[model samples]
Target: MPSDIHHPAAAFNRTSFEACVVPYLDAAYNLARWLARDDTDAQDVVQESMLRAFRYFHSFHGDDARVWLLAIVRNTFYSLRSKAAADAKHETFDDEAHTLIDEAPSPEARALISVDIQALQAALENLPHPLREVIVLRELEECSYKEIANITGQKIGTVMSRLARARERLKAELSSSSTEARRHDVR
Candidate 1:
């Protein structure tokens, strides 16, 4: 263990948690929720993460608690994922905005997108967790490479590589879904 791990402040202190950590609670909850995808599971993971963070607060320093806490949330989420394996298969989504194939889409196409955000959410929910997280964090959350690496415990290089791959996979998925929609219309 590092020297910080041995300090009294590293052990347990409610005031420390309140001062250094309370501000980040929501961010922790959000990251955990995104990774876990169920209200109960997300809450469970956040609680576990906060407890562990309290125990290890000495190891935390500087002004990076938010990213550091998110890393914990990510790890806790993965542990729960392995143990439970009965939750939503999480997926990462991209931030590329799709313009209306035409703003003045024909009634038929309007009917298609009338399915709207719900259909998009369902499609996002269907993606694998790795792809989903990368897409959500990178595109939706608009996190920088350093921030992502800090939260994910991945090397910045790995983040970039995985981010590129995640975008490619999401592109493939949307392309296929669009094809299917077109096929349905032709029938």
Candidate 2:
């Protein structure tokens, strides 16, 4: 047996690790997929993150396993991102000017609007990384602001702020895409 096996406070048992951490494998991989923007790279990130998590499992305090694992995933992603090609540059999105009002379209207007999944996916891909992350965590993962903050190591207020900006940007991008498609159809 390992020398540290007898520590009662350490939640490092393999059984506990499987119970708490294994269930969230999809969530971890989904997050990595979005951040890495490539299936192969995302797989690599999740594998590395799971290894890191297991190696440090002794330190886990038995909090929300999803959040803890995601934080590890986030760190691993940035580490990988940093080591990627120098062509990757930090980008700032000016969302303030691009903000569009959120209004429900009438049935008639809705009928005229056409948005394909590919365009929506492209718009999501176009969002800046920070905004994309918050959107993915909150909207896709259904995480609360507090959970998102814990996962991202941001304050609750910052998470709220980012979510709002991300939504606004996404809406604007989708609306513009719809309009462009309409014009092309008319031609």
Candidate 3:
């Protein structure tokens, strides 16, 4: 067998894969982070998604690479989530062994984050997964409705409806949070 470096087809595939997929690694990680809601889990999801993309690179036509990659990322996250849920069912919960701890940030660390930013992040986190993912894709990643529909495997109409609902929910959450904050300030 010839070495891959000397093989023209192999070299071309590798180059094309790098050119199409490597530039979107950060975007992939951001989507995963928002979906998984945990830094370590998001990193793991991105790693698995990249491996899947590389394995299936040959099947990829000359379409939108970002949408393709994000779809894979979204699928991988849901797969892992489902598997984790199944695994949790078999585990025994021990109250003593799983004691919760309060991990509040230091005052300096808290001060570094803007109040409005924190409230927004908290509200986003509180949204259901479906709404949250759509909001993150459209608002944060700047994906169009068609791209989001492709990434989410939803119809364009569904994507639009979800986005509208997510926006309204976010507005209500932000308004309530600001009101509470103002009350605290006045006290």
Number of the predicted model whose lDDT against the real structure is largest:
3
Instruction: Encode model 3's per-residue lDDT on 1-187: one tens digit a residue.
Output: 5346658887898899999998999999989888887777888999999999988998899799999999999999999999896644222222232233334866443433345566777788788899999999999899999999999999999999999999999999999887876655521
Best candidate, TM-score-wise?
3
Model 3 per-residue lDDT at 24: 94
Clashing pairs in 2: none
lDDT of 2 by residue, 22-52 (tens): 8999999988877877777788999999989
Q: Each model's C-alpha lDDT?
A: 0.72, 0.80, 0.84
Which pairs, if any, clash in model 1? 90-129, 91-132, 92-131, 92-132, 92-133, 93-136
Error of 3 at 149 (Å): 0.6
Clashes of each: 6, 0, 0
Candidate 3, residue 78: CA error in Å? Answer: 0.6
If ranked by lDDT, best first, what sequence of candidates would result? 3, 2, 1
Task: Give me the runs in candidate 2 sitting further than 4 Å from their true place.
Answer: 1-12, 88-115, 181-187
Mark the 10 consecutive residues where model 2 has the least summed lDDT.
Answer: 93-102
TM-score: model 1 vs. ground truth: 0.66
